[model samples]
Target chain A: MLSIKNLHASVEGKEILKGINLEIKAGEVHAIMGPNGSGKSTLSQVLAGNDAFEVTSGSVTMNGENLLEKETEERARDGVFLAFQYPVEIPGVSNLQFMRTSVNAMRHHRGESEMNAAEFMKLAREVSKQVDLDPAFLKRGVNEGFSGGEKKRNEIMQALMLQPKLAILDETDSGLDIDALKVVSDGVNALRAEDRAILMVTHYQRLLDHIVPDFVHVLADGKIVKSGGRELALELEDRGYAWLGIKDDETAANSAN
Target chain B: MTTANKEVNELIKREYEHGFVTDIEVDTFEPGLSEDVITRLSEIKKEPQFMLEWRLKAYRRWLEMEEPDWAHLGYDRIDYNSVSYYSAPKRKEDMPQSLDEVDPELLKTYEKLGIPLHEHAKLAGVAVDAVFDSVSVATTFKEPLAKAGVIFCSISEAVRDYPELVQKYLGTVVPHTDNFFAGLNAAVFSDGTFVYVPKGVRCPMELSTYFRINAANTGQFERTLIIADEGSYVSYLEGCTAPMRDENQLHAAVVELVALDNAEIKYSTVQNWYPGDENGKGGIYNFVTKRAACIGKNSKVSWTQVETGSAITWKYPSCILRGEGSVGEFYSVALTHNHQQADTGTKMIHLGKNTTSTIISKGISAGKSSNVYRGLVKFGPRAEGARNFTECDSLLIGDQCGAHTFPYIESLNKSAIVEHEATTSKVSDEQMFLCRQRGIDMERAVSMIVNGFCKDVFKELPMEFAVEAGKLLEVSLEGSVG
Candidate 1:
């Protein structure tokens, strides 16, 4: 469903994602574990088409369609979702209104009829329950004055509503409490399907316990040093990436191979 | 229109929108300042002698005064003599008694401007006073307003019939010498709506004035004076729009409000004067002076405005809290798109003890436009226990546009509490992505986000105006984001 070939990326003239190569099929959960500044967030931003980051080399494709050429919104309509590490606070925009607009926009882009107010409210109600979000909060401004946990949960709820083909959760569990993490994971787990893929980016191995990954790739200094099963997260958790002794360039070569 | 046609038409249209007129039919006089024009305008209105003398005094004071340049705006020197002192729609010797008697073409023009005066005449609820150029075309609900002892009519008629009321309140809140435009409006304003809510009476319906500019190369100078007597309440709405022209038309208007002890006045404006075209050609230069005074104890006055037009808009509808425990509020949403420029905000002067004021301003700039929020909150020495809260936010749609907030806070009383908050930001791609990821397309996302950014001020508007404002923002920022 997704392919990245020698994905070299930089932000503000500094190289971050150094020749990253990855392949994922549908219905699979992939976890990318990296140390601080290992380009974990940068990779997510680059994939989501953040203008700040420049892709210096390589190509990315989703379902055989070139992704880099598409605008951020176009990429999103084509079924790509990125859960931000820090959710933006839009003061005057209500969460529910934002959700409805997004859902209808995506539907419109797919050449489908737009949803009426009643239909949108119905979907919002259902999704709110799935993410354990209170309906009242939906009427509040988008992420304005929201707690960290609420922001993460709202992102999950949005993802659940959009039902994207590829869901990239970047540090979704970073600031969430145990309860919020559980709710978010449950929402993500419910979204798992045969034709969908999940890319979980995290520093801690704890999230892996909730949403177990089929493939765990350890990223260090902008490259993936090792790739293994769920046990790899446990190994990295027990003994940090120092034991690997693999620099970022070596990891890129290994992943390319 | 197709994009190509729009482009071609826009070029031809641009020249006319901003071109200077040379041979337009205009009634003019000599360049120097004088009381003669004031007397002539009053005589044309057939106003009483006292009103004529009032104008004479104001005109004399205006000559001694200097044009105000303190406002955060810039413009070339105005050729005062070149401007006509009065330019009314040619009316029959006899006044029109009904809608059918009025000029059908003029009525059609009003209809095209979205003000259905004929229907309003038939409707029982809404009352409208259609002011064209420099004269009142027709006033609806005259009898109904008269039944309540509420004198709602043209300022000219008020000078003739309700002389005492007009004399008691005119220029009391905002003196003629207050500013250059105010003095000019006081001197040469041909005619405008005059509303008087009697003491202890609640106005039965919303009072509205629709101002239109039709004659070529003529400035529209209208004066609006609304007085809500003690224990009275009234809501007055004003809307303005002009025909497409190439040369920059001048529209300098003055609106004054007086809220007596325990009285409340709410004034709202939706100004859509012809904004110059995309390349900043031909549109109205709207320089207006609107101010209100809370004179009696516990009196309240509020100003709400939605400015979405004009080539250069310079207006600051303000309030003066003179009575103890009086309240003043200003809520504004100014949008400048496609080469428009606006410098507007409000001022609240707290002079009485325990007075309070609140100001919320939201400015959106797109397409090389510039929007500014310049406000002042002042607390006098006797204004003990005064409090004020102000919030100004700007949303920049494109990098080429600019938004600025200049708030002046002065407190002479040590017990006063004043707080102000302002922020400027561009719509971020990341934020748009988050919305799109939720299924919102980029345009919808932009609209939703921008609306949210202005939700704080929108909530302050009346229900109907709030909805209209939301939709207006959407239309104003169309094609702003990709």
Candidate 2:
């Protein structure tokens, strides 16, 4: 359902994603693991249509529609979701308000009537429970003064509420405690379905234990250098990236190039 | 470069919707101001002898006073001599005794401005005094208001009928010699609304007045007076719009409100005068003076204004808390875009013991516009244990715009407590991108954020007016993305 061909991306005159190719089918979950500066976050941003990353060469398509041609919001309307590693704080804009606007925008794009206030409130409450967030927090400014763990859970809640076709979780487990990690993973596991796909990008192998992936690819520099099964994450965790012939950031970035 | 951004660009190019000139013959004075002109205006209104004397005295003071330049504004020098002092629709030999006989064209102009004269639309039940150009055309819901012992009519009519009320409170709150614009307004003020709620009475409904400027080269000087007697309460609303023109039209208005013993008055205004073109060609110079006096113990007065238009605006709605335990509050949201400039705030004077005041101001500047918040709070010697809290926030949408704040506080009582807080913020790219990525478009995102920024002030507005204010801000900030 998703395809990326020779995705070469750059930012501010520096190439980040160099000659990367990947294809994922429906009902599949893929994990891309790498050390620092392995272009893991760059891959997620380029897929989500961050304009700062210039896609010099290659194309991305979702269900035969060129995802690269759509604007960021249009991409979102087309069912692409990105869980930011650092959630933005929009003071004065309540989280509930933002969620309602987003939900209505998607509904409009799908030729559906707006969700009524009561119906929206019900859906919001149900989603908040799934992420273990108190509904009262929804009335506060979006992520304003939120804890590190709460921000990650809020991002997951947004993904769950939108119910996108392809979800990209970028460093969702970085700043989470053990309890928050379990709660967030449970929400993600609940969202897994036959017609949806999940792309998990992480540096540590810890998250793979919670939401196991069908495919694991090791990204070095800007290319996917290794593709394997769940066992690959366990092996990397035991021996580290050096065991896979990957040195520290200095050598890994050059050798992969 | 998204569809939302493109739509915002188109909205920015939209022409002024309320700029159409009404086709009606008018009785307009020649372009100039003199003692003779003031005398003629008083005679046309058929004012009492004292009214004429007041106008003449104000005109003399105006001549001696130079235009003040203390405000944070920049514009071409106003050619006062080139502006017509009065322009009113020529009344028929027999004026309309009811709404039906009113000129259809004049009624249509009000209709086009989303104001209904039939009294059955959404704004029904609220008494409205429609002032066109320099004279009031019609007053609606007068009978209902009158049956409730409420005196609601045009200032001219009030002078003719309830002379005592008008004479007692005309310039009491904002005296004729208050400032440059106030003096000019007092000198040649043509027409406005007069509202009086009798003692021990709460007004049955909201009282509103709509001011429209259609005549070219004419200056609109309106005088609005409202009096809430002892133990009474009233909410008064004022709104204005002007037709588009190539030359800046002058709108100098004075509003005075009085709240007697244990009385409460709430005054709200939504001012949307023309803000000229994108490059700032022609608009309205809106210099208005509004003041309320708490004259009796425990009397309360609040001023709420949403200012979103005008090429240059200089206004300060103030309250004088003279009575013991009286309360004063000011809530404002001022937005300036596309070369528009606004310098507006409030003044609160605590002259009695235990008096309190609160101020919340929100200023949004977009495009190349400039917005400033200038406020003052004073505590007199007898204002023992008085308190004041002031909060001001400024939001900038683009790099070319500017925001400034000037707050002055003076306290003579050692027991008085005053607090002030101010903040400045920009619409960052991260916030914009986050909203866009969530499927909400940029234009909606900008407006939503701005509305959130102004939520405090908007809540103070009446329901209908709050909705209108939200829409006005959205239109004003279109294409202001940086």
Candidate 3:
């Protein structure tokens, strides 16, 4: 239920995503793998309505609604979720307060009454257990002084709490330990269902082994160069991006013209 | 602009909520200052001979005192001669003997500000001395307080009824020569609350005073004195508000407290005067002096204030720890927005052995306002084994606002220990983006964050007042986020 056509984006007057096209129907999981400078994170941020990235020429639609025209918060209420690679720390706002406010916002948009504190607390405890986080973290400031692995798991916990229709996981496994990776993957696996789509952006194939994807695409110089089935990931894992005839960083990216 | 910023911009434009004027006839003196004016004021109140003599003496001292300008403030020179000294509601009879006798319009004015003066209301149980303009029209829970051996009434009444107590303690802590503002307040002060807790008695209920300035071109000078006799304990609260006007009105108030042997006193204030318009056209210039003296051994005193308004504020509530093993504490939360400027803090003077003090100050500045924290902690040679701890934190919201800290510390005894810490922070854009991404409204996010920053100070306020203080900060911060 998501479509991106010839999406071109830039930051600070320098182009990043150039004429990339992708479409995914419901109940499908798509993984886009690329090198360090292939604009993998930039693509996710642009879709999340980050104003820093200038969407020069393209169109994005979620269920036929113009996604680019909506503000960041409106997109969030419209079931769009982005798991940040580096979670921001709000030193004084408790994690429980932050999550409850977000969940209530989504429920309000769906014409449902806000949940009371007691009811919200029960749901939050269950989600925290699923992500292997201690209940005590709820009382602490949001992501304040959290370990790298805990922050990644907190992002997964938030995603599970929001239950978005279009979940964009941007390098969720970058900083997780092996055990935390297992817990986070289980949470993501539980999110799969009918009428929902998932997009995973990553640089490693290790995450692919946990929650296998239906489709894999190789992104290089802001363009999806190759598309294949699940086995393509294992092939690319054996031979690096150079074997795919794509330079990682020093390519200048002039080919976008 | 993004939708989050756009929504906040609208809220930032909200006008001050308590800006309406009360329509009533008033007896106002012409705008000027002289010995004749002070004499007329004392005569109108029909004070005792000693009281009139005291006012004349203070007026002479005020004349000799050049208006002090050493504060960290920038403002036009105040024309003292151009300000009317006395303005009170026109009354043809004696003071109101009961709620039924008070003018309905005056009661309505208090009602519009969410302060119910009727005895049946729950708030009336707190014993409020409602000071309007330059005179006190009503005081609550007088009989119950009197039964408890607590003398609670207006200062004017105290001078006439409890002359011995008034003569014993008035001006003893902060004398007429204390400072410029205190000198002015002592000379031409109109009316304020006077509270006395008898020996070995705890006040039956919290005492509060609400000061309202409704007349135009009149400066409000309030003088308050609270005495806790030996082995007594009491808590007093003061709140002030004024109507919106284009001419800069002046508010000069002096508050003094005295604690006897083993006695304790707690004072709290929430000052929300008009802070002028966005371009700084008109508001109140609040210059107040408040102090307490712990003269008896083991006495304690604490000051808590939440100041959120005023075009320009200059106040420093202080404590003199003269009793052995006495304790002093100060907690403050000052927020300034629009064109407001505030320079407020506290002072702790240790003169006896084993005296201790603690200070926690939080200043929040938004829009084009400026907030400053100026504090002093001094230990004399007799203060052996004394200690003091201080913490100051500032949070800046917009790019144009400013925050400053000036802490003066002095110690004569080698055994004295002083610890001070200061920090400055901002509401970063990334933090805003994070909250906005969660679909929380802009106003809610800012208020929540600011409330968290001020949680430490709000807890020190009384139970009901803590809630009001939080809401006041939210209202004050409105339209400050653009």
Candidate 4:
């Protein structure tokens, strides 16, 4: 459902993603695990077409359409969703209004009729229940004064509402307790469609234990150095990243030994 | 990215829609100001002798007063002598008894401004008094209002027909000697709306006035007065728009409202004067003075305004709560864009025991414009058990714009309670990116956030006006995003 060829990216004159090549087919779930500063987040941002990060040399295609040539909003309309690592807080815009505008924009792009307020509210309530988010939070400002877990659930609710073809989850498990982690996993598992693809990016193996992936790729120094099955996450967790001979700036190799 | 910013800029650079001029024969005075000019103005209006004396008194007082410079604004010195004191569309010597007798071109001008003078027009529930340039051309629904024992007419007509009521309330709340602009407005004010709700009578419909500046080089000085008698209630709306011009025009208006025992008055304004070009070349300089007085026990007054235009705006709508247990409210939203500058707010004075007041102000600044909020709350010695609450919030859209707050509070009553809150925020980069990532464009996102910030003030406006106010904010903030 998604394809990337030799993705090279940078931010403010500093290279971040050296060369990222990945491919995922329909109905498969892929997880990319890496240590800090390993370009896991950069890949998600690049796929979403964030203006802060420039693709120095690369091409991304979603559903056979050139995604990199589209604007940020156009890419979202084209069914590419990126759940942000740190969602922004907009003080004045309500979450319901935000969701309605997004849903209508996508529907308009697909030559479908816009959803009425009643239907929109009904869909919002139904999907929010799946993510364990209270309906009261929908009337509040977008992510304003929200806790980390609530924000993650809200992101998932948005993804469920849009029903994107490709969804990239960036650090969705961070700052969540065991209960929230379980709820988030349940929501993702419910959205497992035969024609959709999910790419999970995380630094730890804890999230994989709930929403296990079919294939695991270890990203080191901006490239996929190893590929294996779900067991690769357990191996990386038992033996720290130093066992892979990758020395970070901190060089905390001895502590792991 | 540069191309996207260019598209955003184009979206913001919308042209002023009501810039067309009407072709009609006009009666205008020469460019100058003098006692003889005021005498001629009163004589032309066929005012009572007392009215002539009042104008002369105001003219004498104005000559001795200097223009106040305390407001934070920059502009070339105004040439009072270079402005025509009066301009009116030529018509029958007598006032038009109905819309049919009014000049067709003048009626067409008002129609172009979205105000229909015919009684059976689309604006169903409201009665409008259309003021063109320097004189009132036509006032609709006067007969129905007269049937309700409500007196609604032009100030000039009231001077001739109901001299006693006009004499009793005129300038009582806002005296001519109040300030520089008030003095000038009193000296040369031509015509505006006058409304009076009789004792125990509720006005049947909303009363409104639409002021338009059409003649070139003419200064519009409007005088408005409304009085709600005992056990009465009324809602009055004021709206204004001017034609585009290269040279800056002057608009100095004075509005005074009075509420008597157990009476209530709600006054709202939507001001859309010509706010010069994007480069700040020429526009209207709007300096207005508006105040309300609660003169009897249990009286109430509220002021809701949306100010969006004018190159340099200096205004303060205030309230004097002099009646025991009286209430006052002020809700305002002021926006400045493309080199516009505005310094506006309200003043609340508690003079009687248990008087209460609430003030909510929202200011938005975009482009290179500057928006300032200056408010004052005072509690007199006899204002025992009085209370005041104030909230001032500002939103900035671009780096080149500016927002400022100046609040002054003074209390002499030991038992009085006063509270103030202020906050400043911006359209953060993170917020913009989040909206864009959610499939919304830059302009729509900025406008939505701005309208949300101003929701409190917008809710205070009348239902139809609230919608217009929201659209006005969106149009004014165009070209402000990247």
Interface RMSD of each: 5.7, 3.1, 2.6, 2.5
| CAPRI grade, predicted model 1 | acceptable
lDDT of each residue in B1-482, candidate 4, tens digit only? 33333334452574777778889999999999999999999988999999999999999999999999999999998999999999998887668877889998988888888898865673787899999999999998888999999999999999999999999999999999999999999999999999999999999999999999989999999999999999999999999888889999999999999999999999999999999988897789999999999998989999999999999999999999999999999999999988899999999999999999999999998878899999999999999999999999998876677899999999999999999999998777667777777788777888888888888888888898899989987787766775
The residue-level lDDT of candidate 3 at B132 comes to 93
- C-alpha RMSD over true interface residues, model 4: 2.5
Where is the poorest 10-residue window by lDDT in model 4 chain A? A248-257
Across B327-369, the per-residue lDDT of candidate 1 in tens digits comes to: 9999988988778889999999999999999999989887778
Q: Quickly count the clashes in candidate 2.
A: 0
Q: Mind giving the per-residue lDDT tens digits that candidate 1 earns over A206-257?
A: 8988999999998878888899999998986665566687433433433322
* Model 4 chain A, TM-score vs. native: 0.95
Off by over 4 Å in 1: A247-257, B1-40, B120-124, B337-340, B366-370, B397-404, B439-442
Residue B9 in model 1: shift from native, Å? 23
Query: Candidate 4 has which clashing residue pairs, if any?
Result: B12-B478, B12-B479
Error of 2 at B22 (Å): 1.4
Candidate 4 structure quality by residue, lDDT tens digits, A25-114: 989999998877999998988888788888999788887888899988888888888888899887767899999988998898899999
The regions of model 3 sitting more than 4 angstroms off are A246-257, B1-11
Worst 10 residues of 3 chain B by lDDT: B2-11
Which tens-of-lDDT digit does each residue in B55-152 have in candidate 2?
89999998999899999999988999999998988877424578877888888899999988864552665778999988999889888888999999
Clashes of each: 12, 0, 2, 2
